[model samples]
Target: MASMARNPLPGTIRKDGRRAFYVYLSPPLIRELKKAALDEERPAYELVEEAVEALLKSRRIARPATDGVA
Candidate 1:
């Protein structure tokens, strides 16, 4: 059996100094991220990164609740 391979992107930096990969998003999400960055006077990349981190944290916290919800 073959497994999927991991390819790292050029500009991603992992917290532990390891490799990080980039995933493409839909155009609509890109537009929304641009709008958010403009409104908050922050870079679009920073805003997107913050959003992704928050989502990951939320998922980790919600996993236990989901497991009990059978």
Candidate 2:
């Protein structure tokens, strides 16, 4: 039988320069994220990114400006 392991490399970068990485969360956390995404009518990834940006800000790490016109 074939192994069920995922690819060892990070997934491809998108045209917008985003790459896919793995994140593991508990089942309850997953449900909460889905619920918040539905309630806010936004993608779950947006919420996750917002949370991560806040975390980085708390650590005093600066994120690059994402305003258009790159």
Give the best candidate by TM-score.
2
> Model 1: which residue pairs collide?
none
lDDT of 1 by residue, 6-59 (tens): 444555556756455467989998899889889999988677678779998888
lDDT of 2 by residue, 1-70 (tens): 1332343344556677666757899999999999999999999988998999888776654545467422
Question: Candidate 1, which segments miss by more than 4 Å at Cα?
Answer: 1-20, 64-70
Residue 14 of model 2: what lDDT?
66
TM-scores for all candidates: the values are: 0.52, 0.66
Against the true structure, candidate 2 reaches a TM-score of 0.66
Q: What's the lDDT of the predicted structure labeled candidate 1?
A: 0.72
Alpha-carbon shift of residue 10 in model 1 (angstroms): 7.6
**Root mean square deviation (Cα) for candidate 1:** 5.3
